[model samples]
Target: MDTNTLMRTLDGTLTCTTLYGHKYRSAITGQDRMPMALEGLTRGKSLWIDSLVHFTCPLTPQQETQHLSRTPVPGSVCLHTPEETVTLHERGADVSFSEHDVPEDSFLSYRPRLLMAVTNITITANEWQHTEEWQLDLEEI
Candidate 1:
């Protein structure tokens, strides 16, 4: 099956779970929800969906490193590092992470150092299936 082509067809809004224990709604394009294309399909009669999901959040260095390290989710993988990207593949899904790449000391000094992060998730399901990505953000309020 053409994973890239199928990914382009599957697109929609997806729910994101955060490591801090919160859920938010984000806008997804055809390329973002590509995983949906595999809905109700099997390996013998199913196709692979290649979709990507992006997320942005404001967080501190301490929060980003500590909270994320202790997170207890198996689906979401940490692409820890400033301006770094990581790829994840699981449950017929492909995931990626992107960050602004900031230094710890610099991040701490920056007022309201809001970290902007993006996650590119790709997955394939036998049936129309939906998955969530959780991120934990810490604040010094």
Candidate 2:
């Protein structure tokens, strides 16, 4: 399948390009903070939550070029799609923090109001397989 056709098959394809930020908390690492006590040490060992967003779609050559030109930059704004949220929910995902109050059900309209940065963008083309796909990876800023 070509990239454009593959995109048409997806429920939602992200088109918006606006970057936003959200507050995230992580323990002060040993390099940054000295443990006050055994409890503090134990608590510090707890894993930190670094939200990640990944999605794949087919893009036109122009779109692919645009993405290649825009991504992996510190200033680039992120884009998202409702299908991404729905998929995450289906997979039992949770938002540890949210800019808006998340209801127990039906946040299909909710677009995460969190700041994210593009970490990587990958384009794969296989002529024999007749497949071209764009993979976007984002990490919490």
For model 1, what is the C-alpha lDDT against the true structure? 0.31
lDDT value, residue 138 of candidate 2: 45
Q: Write the per-residue lDDT of candidate 2 for residues 26-113, one digit (tens) a residue.
A: 2222211222233332211332233233223332222211122112222222223333342222111222123323333322212222
Pairs clashing in candidate 2? 20-115, 21-115, 22-115
Once superposed on the true structure, which residue ranges of model 2 sit more than 4 Å away at CA? 1-109
* Model 2, C-alpha of 88: deviation from truth (Å): 22
lDDT of 1 by residue, 21-137 (tens): 333323233333333443443323311221133332344453433222121223444343455544332221222222334345322111111222223333433334444332322
Using all chains and alpha carbons, the TM-scores for the candidates as numbered come to 0.19, 0.23
Runs in model 1 deviating more than 4 A are 1-51, 64-76, 83-141
Per-residue lDDT of 25 in model 1? 26
Where does the lowest 10-residue lDDT sum fall in candidate 1?
Answer: 106-115
Compute the lDDT of residue 114 as modeled in candidate 2: 36
For every candidate, C-alpha RMSD to the true structure in Å: 18.1, 20.6
